[model samples]
Target: MKRVYAKEDVCIGCRLCEIACVVEHSESKNAIRTYKTEVPRPVARNVVEERGPLTFSVNCRHCDEPLCVAVCIAGAMVKDEESGVVRHNEEKCVGCWSCVMICPYGVIKMKPAAKKVSKCDLCNGRTMPACVQACPNRAIVYEER
Candidate 1:
């Protein structure tokens, strides 16, 4: 199955991906409206890291044999057979951070306001992932390869 991949060499360390992710998941559909709040935390599924001249965004790999799924004691994480996407159930999550610990990429984060672990779900809808759409350098791309 295809997935979103990042080219670190091409990434410019711009946080448009982060902003887009938060806006996409915000209660208010409007991006400008969502930013007016005092908190203004978007909780993006992807995180960008800078290592000198290189930068990259990290997110869920949706691994074929995901350790997060195996480590979730609450059974909050599950993989979709049809789409090959790994998803989380906030209701089922116990906020133990087991999935976070198990994830090799360190992409998962706990949203304190939501009281649940949040990670990339590949958009899973009509719209493509916010990170992919927001990337200015075209470093992030969604494909079947």
Candidate 2:
């Protein structure tokens, strides 16, 4: 399976990817309306990290040996055998936070109000993730190795 990777050297930390992520997953998929009408707004699955002179976006790596899946009590987290994407089944999630504790990348997050966990699913709706498409500087790309 192809995955999203970052070229930190070109990342401008503009957060376009973050914005695009929120909009992509937004209820209506509209940037302006989603912000104005949605209460508290949507939290992005992918996060941008910035240091003194460094910037990079991070999300679920869908690791070969994901500890998150092993500890998920609700069995909501699973790596798709065909795609190798670590998918979180929101309906099956028990909000146990077990995956949150076990993820070495610190990427998994809780949607407390929704009583579910959230992580990157690689945007199955499209060929590429919203973040990758939205990155103006091409700091991010989807590649298979």
Candidate 3:
């Protein structure tokens, strides 16, 4: 399965990944329109971490043996076989944060208002994720290696 990987050496920590992630998952469909205050808060599935000179975006790996799925007591997380994307079911979630605690990358975030967990799902139906599309530097990409 081809997965999205990062070349940390090329990353500038501009956070286009985070913006793209949030836009892709938004309900408004229109990225610009979704930014209005009336629209719900945008949640990012990928997050960037900065440590001095290095910075990189982190998201779900969709691991073959995912620890987050195993630790989710509410069974809200599932890995899609065809796409190798880990999806979250907000309805089933109990907001327990077990997945957050067990995720090695710390990519999962708690949606305080929604009372659920959110993470990258790779824009399952789209050709590419919003983050990948919005990145001007091509820091984030979807490809098969």
Off by over 4 Å in 3: none
Structural similarity to truth (TM-score) of each candidate: 0.92, 0.95, 0.90
Instruction: Indicate the worst ten consecutive residues by lDDT in candidate 2.
Output: 38-47
Instruction: Order the candidates by lDDT, highest first.
Output: 2, 1, 3
The most accurate candidate by TM-score is 2
Give the lDDT of residue 81 in candidate 2: 89
Model 1: lDDT to the true structure: 0.85
Query: How does candidate 2 fare on TM-score?
Result: 0.95
Off by more than 4 A, model 2: none
The residue pairs found clashing in candidate 1 are: 2-144
lDDT winner: 2
- Which candidate do you rate higher for TM-score, 2 or 3? 2
lDDT of 1 by residue, 1-145 (tens): 8788999989999888988888888888567877887374667888899989889988899999888999999989998877888999989998888888889989888887666899888876835788898899999998888
* lDDT (C-alpha, whole model) for all candidates: 0.85, 0.88, 0.79
RMSD of each: 1.6, 1.1, 1.6
| Candidate 2 residue lDDT tens string, 54-113 | 999988899998899889888888889888998888889998888888888778877888
* Candidate 3 lDDT tens digits, 34-127: 6674245768888888899898776778888889989988888988776677878889999999999999989888887777888877777778
